[model samples]
Target chain A: MREAYHEQLNQLADHLAGMCGMVADAMELATKALLDADLAIAEQVISDDAKVDEARSVCEEQAYALLALQAPVATDLRTVLAAIHAAESLERMGDLALHVAKAARRRHPQPVLPEPVKPYFAEMGRVALKLAHQAEQVIHTKDIDQARALEDADDEMDDLHRHLFTVIMDKDWPHGVASAVDVTLLGRFYERFADHAVSVAKRVVFVVTGRMPGSGDEEL
Target chain B: MREAYHEQLNQLADHLAGMCGMVADAMELATKALLDADLAIAEQVISDDAKVDEARSVCEEQAYALLALQAPVATDLRTVLAAIHAAESLERMGDLALHVAKAARRRHPQPVLPEPVKPYFAEMGRVALKLAHQAEQVIHTKDIDQARALEDADDEMDDLHRHLFTVIMDKDWPHGVASAVDVTLLGRFYERFADHAVSVAKRVVFVVTGRMPGSGDEEL
Candidate 1:
């Protein structure tokens, strides 16, 4: 019975990692749509979001079932609880990617990225996708160092986000107000996408160390 | 022992409702700051967000303790799980309010809302505050009808969000590119704030009916 419960917990982790992969794929495609004005890819990302949402619902239901039947305690309990939170974080990441895809679709045929802002958004996309991939690995490995490193990566995304604004706020911004609005929102979607990855990584660290990330020496 | 566990579960609900109240207050103040250019109120909202975060942490911890110690099953287990999700929703609402405050601060001494957009945002604020208050009631009453009504209110917010873009995209948009960016983000913040409220309400409906809200007769 104990072995079975442990196996269930492992399955929950695997499901979460699966979610991370889906989000990474969605962001990768959504970013491509944003850069190339590929309407088909953007639409695909939007439709694909439902799959992530369904996976999250399944994951959470499994969690409730495990708790009800197994009543896991101590470390096992924390692991399941963290999985629930991590599922939520990943679901939100998928939603953020969906938002990115929607933005791309809204500007369909007309590239959402003004030429000046194109390179910055391309970098944001790469960073966001990389973070998602790294986050999936952290979910499986529970590497505390790697989880902490995701935070540093998030800081880089933030820098990129700030620089994006500078380009818009530049006195010589060639694009009109509408383009600036789209660019600002696009920057936000990518920044928030990275933020969710860091959040999931933090939960993974908590699962491993039983110490909430950023809680320092304070034990949970 | 059963009675004690039940009492703990009630406390968890109370904590969640308390979070809803804090988020409502934060949005109210943040909106006021945005319209009036009140830096102090914006700063107050920003600083107060930590309290909401702490409250959510406490609420989740209590739920975890109840699950671990009581080993609740069936409806009781579902209630605890819903509380965890609801607490997260409220915490995110608080974050959205914090964002509204931060945006106001960014434009400090200068109102974030241009004159043409002021009334629109003002209405958004009222709608958001109304939804938050209604959401608090839904948390306590679990009134399925009221919970469902929150979705209609969310539709109202969505309409307002769309209208905001229309105003921004108007040929006579009085504000320049930067102001348009600010207004667009402000609209998004309010829309998302209301969205969190609707999500919490849906969870409440699920708790009461044992059928997922929007799932209709389909059982999850």
Candidate 2:
């Protein structure tokens, strides 16, 4: 029974890592859909988001089962509870990706990113994908260093997000209000996607170090 | 031990209700700051966000202690786990309020909303505050009727949000791209604030019914 309990715990972590992988792929595809204006891939990402939702449900159910039947204590208890929070974060990351895809679908045939702003988004997507992959690794390894590294990578995303804002708000910006609005929202989606990835990494830190990374959602 | 455990559960519920009250107040003040360009009040909301964060930490700590010491099952278990999720939703709602406040501060001396868009924000603010209060009440009563009511109310907010976009994107829009960006992000903040309030209400329904309101974060 103890062995099975531990196995269940391991499976919980594995499930979280797998969800990260799903969102990472989702973010990548969504980014592609946004840049290339591929309606089909965007639609595919929108539909595939259901899988991430299912995985979140699975994570929560497994955590509940572990708590109810196994009553895991100490580190194990934290692991179960952290799994719940981590799944929420990853699921949010998936939604952020979906929003990116939706942006693409909304503007089908015409790319969401104008030429001037395309590079910023490309870099943001790269950083967001890297953060998601790091979140997956952090979940599996619980390596404090790897988890902390996500925060640093997220800084690059933040810079890109801020820079994109300047481009949209620039005096010479050719893309009028509509395009500016689109870029503003898309920038936010990518930034928030990175934030959720950092949030997932924070959960790993909480589980391993038994300390919070910051106050709450604002910081994360 | 059983009696004490149930008290802790009630405390957990009470804490959630209190946090909603905090955010409801925060949302109200933030909206006022946005509309009036009240720098002092905006600054107050920004500083006071820490209280919401503190409340969240306290709730999570109380929950962790409950799970570790009590090993509650059945509804009790659901109550504790749902508390964790609910607290997170409430905290994010607080952050949304903070973001609105920050938007106000960024454009201090100049109102964030252009004249035409003011009515829409005024309506959005009213609906968001109402939802927050409803969320507080639902946390207290676990009233499914009230919980479901929040969803219906949120549709109004969504319409207001959509309408704001139309106004901002209109060719006659005189606020230029900068104001449009501000309004876009502000609209998102308000919309997301209402969504979090709905999410908190859904947690109550989940505690009572063990069902999901939707797929995950996107729907929430």
Candidate 3:
């Protein structure tokens, strides 16, 4: 029974990593949908968000059961709690991806990105996917260094986000108001997605080291 | 020991409600800062956000202890878990309020909202505070009815959010792209704040009813 309990605890991390993988795929597809104006792919990303939400429920229910039934000790208890936080962050990442897809769907035939900013968004999508996968690995291995690396990658994404904002706020911006609003929200979506991925990796670091990265106990 | 555990569980709810009250005040002060472009008030809201983060740590550590040492059963287990969720939501609401305050500070002495949309933001702020206070009450009482009422109030917030967008997107908008971007993000910050409030209330309903308070299981 004790052996099975430890295995279940390991499985909780596995579930969180799996959910991160799902959101990564969702964001990748959603980014494609946004740049290409592919409504079908956009809809798929939106619908698949449910799977990510379900995955969170899986992690959470497992977490609650572990805490209630097994009475895990300090480190193990912290692991389960961290799983809860990681799962919620992954779930939110999925929502951010869905928001990206919705932006694509909202514009339908007209591409959301106004040509010049297209490559930036494409890069943002790639960075977001890479960060999510890195986060998954961090959760799996409990690698504090890899988790710390996620923050550096997130900084790169933030740079890209600021780049997009510059394009939007440029005095000579040609896209006008509606397109500007779309880009603003889409930039925020991608930026927030990366932030959550970093946050997920930080949770792993906290589980292993009991210290939140950055200046203090709280993370970005 | 069990009796003390039960008392701690009750205290958990009290702490969450207190945190909600803090965020509510933060948002109220933040709204003032935004409209009046009050740098001092904005800075205060930004700094006070740490207290809400500390409150979440308090709730989370208490929860982990209750789960590990006390081993609460089913409903008690769910309540503890829900408290964890509620605390996180309240912390996020505090962040959203900070976002608003920062927007104000970013354009110090210059109001974030234009004359026409100022009332919309003012109303959004009012609704956000109301929803948060209602959420605090629901958390304390675990009253499903009060929790349900939060959704209706959130609908009002949503309408105000949409109204802000309409103002931003108007063809004759004189605020320029920078101001439009600011309004878009600020509108989202306020809308998201209210959503978290309703989400907090929903957690209370979930603890009481074992349902997620939406069509299937997702709250939002």
Candidate 4:
């Protein structure tokens, strides 16, 4: 029974990792939709959200069953709990991607963001993609160092986010309220995407170290 | 051993309920500060956030210890797990309240929200307060119907949020970027506060029903 539970738990972890990949792809596609103003990709991201939700439900059910049946203790308990946490984080990531896609779809014909902010948006996209990939690596290898690196990478995205805000705040730009709203919303999406990735990294740290990282003394 | 574990689980639930009360009060204080533009109250909210965090940590540690030492299964396991979820939701509520307080402090003497929107803000605040109180009741009574009502109340906040945006968009609010940012952030705080309340309610439902509420529902 223990071996079977272990196998079930491993399968759940793999499913979570796979969901993260899909969420990462959704973010990538949503970012591209924003940059290229591709309505098709935007709609695709929005429509595909149900799949992510389904994956989350399955992962959650599996974790609950393992806890109920196996009565897992200590490390095994932490692993199951972390799987649930990771699944929720990934689900939220998918929702953030959907939010970005919805915003992109709203301003279909006209570009959602100004050309000046393109570089920042691109960098944000790259950073988010990297974080997502790193999260999957953490799940697969349970590598605390890789997870730590993902945490560090979020700082760069934060810097870029601040820069984007500065650009928006500049009086030189003749943009209207729509532009400001788009920029602010876009910044929020990027920041939250990074935050969810950090959450995943933190869970990985917890899984390996049996303690939550960045809880004290460590800069988050 | 089972009886002791059950007793510890009950104690954990009580602690979680206490934390929820703290969070609800913090949220109420923060909203009042926003509505009244009271800097002192906002500061108090900020200062009290550490206490909420501490409460959450204690609850988590207790739940973890119970699970590790007692290895609770079946209903006992579910009860402990629900406590963990409730702690996280309460912590998030505290954070949301802090966000509101921080935003309020930043805009001391908050410019009178356009007269037309004052009632909307008030209504949002009232609903939030009620939801917070309802969350406490749900915890105390383990009443699924009361919890469901809290979930339904979330839609009211959502409606108010939409109305707020509509008003902002309809009027040519001269303040432009600052006003828009302030209003948007405020709306986000209210929405998030309600979301946390609903999450707490969901946990309550989970505790009683032994299954999550709105799990497969995609209406949200």
Candidate 5:
């Protein structure tokens, strides 16, 4: 029974890693769709979200079943719990990617981004994809140092997010209110996507060190 | 042991309902701060969020303990799991309210909403607070009917959100990019708060009916 529980735990981790990969692909495709104005890729990313949702449900069910049957305690319990949360964070990352796709689709035929803010989004997209890949690695390795590094990557995303505002707030911004709203929401989507990745990394940190990363509190 | 488990479940429900009230209050104050430019109210809402976080952690710990020690199955398992999810949704709602407050604080003496968009935000705030109260009611009663009704309330919020965009997109829109960006994020914050409330309601629907609300699929 103990061996079976360990096997199930490993399976949960594997499932989480798979989810991370799916999200990374979704974000990459969504970013391309946003930049290139490719409706086909945008639609694909939007539709592919259902698969990520399915993956999350599968991971959640396995965790619940493990709890009901084996009732593993201590670090085992934390691992299962962390798996549930990490899956959720990954699922949300997929949803953020979907939002990006939908935005891309909404402004189809016409490019959503104006010229001045284009470079900022391009960099944001690059940072987002990099973070997504790192998020996957954090899940697979459960390395505390890598998990901390993910937070730094997320900080870069936040800086890029702030830079977007500076451009919009400048006197020369000629895109007007509609484009500003689009840019604001787009920057937010990428920033939030990175936030969820950091959250997944924090869960990994919790599993390995028995401490919540951001709060640095041992009790949680 | 069965009765003890049942008692803990009831306590968890009670705790979740309490969180709902706190979140409702937080949203109200945050909205007031945004509309009135009241820094003190914004600060209060921001500070009160810590209490909400503490409440969520307590609820989660209790749910985890129940899963580990009691190993509830079937409907009982679903209820505990739903409580965990509902608590998370509620906690996120609190965070959204905090974001609203932070935005309000950042703008300080100046009102975030311009004259033309003020009414839309006012209406959004009203709908948000109303939905938060309804969310609390649904948790306390677990009325599947009311749970479904909350979705309609959420639909109203979506409408209000769309209206903000229409106002911004209009040729007559006088606000510059800065205000437009602020309005976009503010609208999104309210929309997401309602979305989380609707998610909590759906979880209640799941617990009562053994079916997920949106998809009607038992697989989740």
Candidate 6:
């Protein structure tokens, strides 16, 4: 029974990693759509959201089943719990990507971004993709160092978000109210996407260490 | 051993209920501060956030210990997991109240809100406080009906948020940039506060039902 439970647990991890991979692809494609003004890709990201949603549901079910059938203890219990939390975070990340795609579709005929802002969005996308990949690694191998690195990466995204806001508030940008709202919402999406990635990393930390990061040290 | 675990689990539930009660108080005080522009009360809300944070850490620790030591299965596992998630949602609710209070403090000495918007702020606050109370009840008793009511109440908050935005956008309001930003952030805070309450209710539903809300009978 213990061996079977272990197999089931491994299967849950596999499903979570798969979901993370899809979310990463969605983030990459969504940003590409935003930067290139590709309507088809944007539409694809929007349409593909249902798959992410489905994956989230499946991951939750598998994790719950393991808890129910196996009655996971200690580290095993933490692993199952973390899988559920990570899946939820990944789903939200996918939703944020879809939001970016929707914004891209709305601004299709002309690019809303000023040239100076392009690099920020590109860098934000790069960091987000990297975080998602790192999250997948955490799920597969439970790599504590990789999870810690993802947390550090989130700070860079925050800096980039601040830069985007500074540019928006600059006097030289002739963009009107519509552009201002678009950029503000876009920055919010990137920030929130990074936030969710950080949340996944925190879950990883909890799974391995049995305590949330940044709280006083307590032995597992 | 099972009896001992049950005792610890019950104690954890009690601590969670205590936290919920404190959070409800904070929300009420924060709302009053916002509606009345009472700086002292706003300051109190900000100061009380540390208590909320401390309570959250304690509850998280207790819940993790229960999971690790008890190795609860089936319904027992669901209960502990739901508690952890509910604690998080409640902690975020406290943070949202602090945010509203901080905004109120920044706009002190003079009212940030115009007289016309006072009624909406009052209504929003009332609903937020009521939802927080309902979430507390749900936590204490595992009451599904009250939880469902809280879910329904979220719609009203959403309506008020939309109304607030409409008022801000109206040309008759003579809105300055600072006021617009203030109102927008306030509206978002109320919306998100209600969202956290809804999340708490969803967790209650999951705890009782052993499946996620909106699963639609889908297989894993």
Maximum-lDDT candidate: 2
**What are the lDDT scores of the predictions, listed in order?**
0.86, 0.89, 0.87, 0.81, 0.86, 0.79
What TM-score does structure 4 among the candidates reach?
A: 0.92
lDDT of 1: 0.86
| Candidate 6 local lDDT, A132-216, one digit each (tens) | 8888888887778888887678888888887877777665556543455566667777877887787887887887787778731
Q: Which candidate wins on TM-score? A: 2
Clashing pairs in 3: none
| Candidate 5 structure quality by residue, lDDT tens digits, A92-191 | 8888888889989999988899977888888888888888888889888888899889877887888888878898888788877888888888888899
State the lDDT of candidate 1 residue by residue for B1-220, as single tens digits. 9999989988998898898889999999999999999999999998998899899889989998998899999888888888998898888888888888998898788888889889998999999999999999988897888888888888888888888888898877767888888887788888888888988888888777887866211100
Tens digit of lDDT per residue, candidate 1, span A20-62?
9999999999989989999999999989988998999999999
Error of 5 at B45 (Å): 0.8
lDDT of 3 by residue, B10-50 (tens): 88889998998999999999999999999999999999988
DockQ of each: 0.48, 0.66, 0.65, 0.41, 0.55, 0.28
- Looking at model 4 chain A, report the run of 10 residues with the lowest lDDT sum: A211-220
TM-score of each: 0.95, 0.97, 0.97, 0.92, 0.96, 0.85
Q: Please give the lDDT score at residue B12 for candidate 5.
A: 93
Q: Between prediction 3 and prediction 5, which has the larger TM-score?
A: 3
lDDT at position A19, candidate 3: 94
**Candidate 5 interface RMSD value:** 5.1
Error of 4 at B88 (Å): 1.4
Q: Which stretches of candidate 6 lie over 4 Å from their true place?
A: A36-38, A105-119, A170-174, A215-220, B1-7, B32-40, B105-118, B170-179, B215-220
Which stretches of model 3 miss by more than 4 angstroms?
A: A215-220, B215-220
* Model 2 backbone overlap count: 0
lDDT of 5 by residue, B79-154 (tens): 9888988888898899999999999999999988898887887888888888888888988898988988877878
- Top candidate by DockQ: 2
TM-score for the A chain of candidate 2: 0.96
What is the per-residue lDDT of model 2 for residues A23-114, given as tens digits with 9 covering 90 to 100?
Answer: 99999999999889999999999999999999999999999999999988888998888899999898888899999999999888888789
User: Model 4, B10-112: lDDT tens per residue?
Assistant: 7887887788789878988987887788999999999999999899889988987887788777667777777787787788778888887887798787643
For candidate 1, give the lDDT of residue B185.
78
lDDT measured at residue A156 in model 3 versus the true structure, 0 to 100:
88
